[model samples]
Target: MCDSVAIIGAGNIGRAIAEGLVAAGSYAPAEVHVTRRRVDRLADLAERGFRVSADNPGVVAACDTVLVAVQPQALDAVLTGIAPRVEAGRHLLVSVVSGASIAAIRRHVGPDVPIVRAMPNTAVALRESMTCLAAEAAHAGALDRVAELFRAVGATLVIDEEHMVPATALCACGVAFFPRAVRAACQGGIEIGFHPEEALRMAAQTALGAAALVRDRGRHPEREIDSVTTPRGCTIAGLNEMEHRGLFLRFHQGDHDLRREGGVAVRR
Candidate 1:
């Protein structure tokens, strides 16, 4: 079993990781420690048996590994405050803060510490996230263990650190993008005579099944599209109409711009 883990900032993603780890049987609730300045915000976790506190240094001192999930602006203070407690050889540091480089963290925590950068979306709460991980070659062993921990909650992909910006937009922001697409489909179903609740369920299940086909069968999206669209069928007609209306074009161009611009800016 993995040693106790301390989540430095138990916000949405951190809390989700804690919940996912426990739900997956990777860690017992008591084995996880969570921290935030406002301890009241962590009452739910406290009730669930997780060690909750407002003391960052205390939590870091007790745990073997640390997952830093603080906002980019708060990172410097958090790292500096806990630096004294972050043991170089004994602790593994995994950061999920977008846009913060490993070198930047090393400045505060020192160079001997093993650090891995990870980006996982909110779907982690449901154990269906697509998490991206990256680390220096020297920290491969630590990275492997981090990967194993995430794989218990969802799938993991190892990618170059340079591509982490695009991965943030594609994987983290993607949770929102897919739901927007599903919402449009649900509206369409409602217009075609289905009740709101019925349309929502049908549209959601269809989206789920479509994603499963591509993921499970390893087939290209266009191949699946071709399989369902007969030359003169309504499916083909709707697809052609959508293409002519620039649905894919608009979404693609916008995403391309975002990626080129270092994937959405991390607000101060």
Candidate 2:
């Protein structure tokens, strides 16, 4: 178990990770330290018993594990600030900052520190994120430890660093994509006369059930569709309509576009 953790730049992703750790009972709130430029924004975390401050280097010096969740643009400054304080062989650095390569981080922190890149969605708040991890061969042990920590909150996969960008588009960005589909379903339900609240609940639950079928049963989506679709059935008709409307094509296009743009597709 990780004895202590410090989340640098405790913004949305940072806060979500901290919440996931505490919610999973992986770490007590007091064992986690959260830092941001504005300490006032972290008052709630302090109230929850987490150590909160604006002193990044101080927190880095105190924690065993450090999660760097700052914006890509802010990464260099944060890394530079904390680099001197990071003790070799003592701190495990897990970065969630998008677009920053492991080599770039190493350049800032030096060669001896173990660095792992993690891509986890906001679903982490619900302990249901699909997190992807990547690290160099030299840091394999640190990667395993970080993977275990993330597994407390959700499923995890280890992949080549070269594939991390694509994984970000598919898993992290896919979080937003799936929710938008659910919202579209809710809209369709509203048009069919269901109350908005009821429609949203039903649509969300149905989506969950569909996903669970694929995950729990290990069935291909098309195979599951075949079981529910029948000749002259409404299911088949709706499926055809969605296909005709380019729903799947749009999703594929979005993935391609994200990849082409270097995986910086989502602003927030």
Q: Find the candidate with the highest TM-score and give its number.
A: 2
lDDT of 2 by residue, 102-218 (tens): 999999888999999999998998899999999999989999999999999999999999999899999989998999999999999999999999999999999999999999999
Over 4 Å off in model 2, which ranges? 266-268
C-alpha root-mean-square deviation, each candidate: 1.8, 1.3
Kindly report which residue pairs in candidate 1 clash with one another: none
TM-score of 2: 0.98
User: Which portions of model 1 miss their true places by more than 4 Å?
Assistant: 265-268
- Assess the local accuracy of residue 53 in candidate 1 as a C-alpha lDDT between 0 and 100: 93
Model 1, range 72-170, lDDT digits (tens) per residue? 899999999999998998999999998899999999998899999999988888899899999999999999999999998899999999989889888
Give the lDDT of residue 115 in candidate 1: 97
Please list all clashing residue pairs in model 2, or write none if there are none: none
